[model samples]
Target: MTVFKVFYQHNKEEVVVREHTQTMYVEAQTEEQVRRYLKDRNYNIEFITKLEGTHLEYEKQSEHFNVEQAE
Candidate 1:
């Protein structure tokens, strides 16, 4: 299976906070798979900016980011 990098954007809102745009990423086989995975987790699919192959070299070229929790 090929490693597909999925980039998507979404919004978050709470009783005391305003909505804002947030970025997300996932490794999947296809775009549809990524969509399904996110949907299953109740994440809305606002926009998909791009999809590309990770080239299986995650160690050499991958950039990591921290996911923050909403309060």
Candidate 2:
């Protein structure tokens, strides 16, 4: 499994802003797996970035970098 940072808007009708967007970390085998694991909602998906190497290391420094396991 790999860690991914998903940026999305809670409301699909609202315009997506980088600053206003919400983020979550998910563990999944693939990008498709991550997408499918998310709850069914009207989410304005922004970006899904796979974190590894130095990037993953950097994120670990933050207090908010909690990984969510996908069932």
Candidate 3:
């Protein structure tokens, strides 16, 4: 599985700005898989980016970083 960083807004119809968005990490096979999982929660997905190498390691260091495995 690869790690993805999902930026989203909860229950909002308007475009989610970067500063106003919430983030989460997901381990999924593809971007579509991540979107499908998050759709259940009805989050307004702003972006999905593959995280790896140095960037992925940097994010992992944050106290708030947590990876949710996508089933």
Candidate 4:
């Protein structure tokens, strides 16, 4: 079985896919069919994994401030 690391642009999430596995597998002969399958299923990567594809990686949207400049 071949393993592929899928990456999402929206949330920057990643997921691993394998043959005959039940992890959002899109099987279609044509590109349109595949697209339709994904769209119909509304499949999305739940969590983003690191480059090693072993652990989940999360990023927080925080603001950084400089205390010295903040008078």
Candidate 5:
């Protein structure tokens, strides 16, 4: 298995809340698997913000790790 760094955003719709960017380290064979793993960890897309100007996004880091680790 390979290690992946997943970058995602979590935002709240409150009046005085800032958007949150989160990172996750996942061990999977493919990027799709990383996404699935994140979902299983309760990072579902429904929690992401979908505002008109700013929308939450996620991406797999270009750097790969042989071991599992996260920040």
Candidate 6:
């Protein structure tokens, strides 16, 4: 499973807008897979403002988790 957070701007005011949070599990095994998925979905390349890597952790005893940059 791969998760992506796509951010965009909707207006000239420059107010940042979080467009979508997407999670996909694809059989294809490369960056090209995700690229093709985006193209197939007709997601505009211009709308994407920024992308950040997400680090996910899980603990059996805890029900909650957090996302942070992994160094």
For each candidate in turn, the TM-score is 0.44, 0.89, 0.90, 0.25, 0.42, 0.29
lDDT by residue for model 5 over 1-71, one digit each (tens)? 55555555553332322255455455567666656555545442322221122111223322432334222
- lDDT of all predictions: 0.44, 0.89, 0.90, 0.29, 0.43, 0.34
lDDT of 2 by residue, 1-71 (tens): 99999999999898878888988899998888888888576788899999999999999888999999876
Q: Where's the lowest-lDDT run of ten residues in candidate 6?
A: 62-71
Please list the residue runs of candidate 3 whose C-alpha ends up more than 4 Å from where it truly belongs after superposition. Answer: none
Q: Model 5 off-target regions past 4 Å?
A: 11-19, 40-71
Q: Candidate 2, which segments miss by more than 4 Å at Cα?
A: none
Comparing 4 and 5 on lDDT, the stronger one:
5
Tens digit of per-residue lDDT, candidate 3, span 8-62: 8886677767778999999999999998888779788888999999999999999
Candidate 1: count of backbone clashes, pairs at least 3 residues apart or interchain: 0
Predictions ranked by TM-score, top down?
Answer: 3, 2, 1, 5, 6, 4
Cα lDDT of candidate 1 equals 0.44
Q: How accurate is candidate 6 locally (lDDT)?
A: 0.34
How well is each residue in 1-71 modelled by candidate 1, as lDDT tens digits? 22334333342233222254344555555667666667645344555533334533442254653222211
Clashing pairs in 1: none
Highest-lDDT candidate: 3
Candidate 1 regions exceeding 4 Å error are 1-19, 51-71
| lDDT measured at residue 68 in model 6 versus the true structure, 0 to 100 | 23
Candidate 5: Cα lDDT at 66: 32
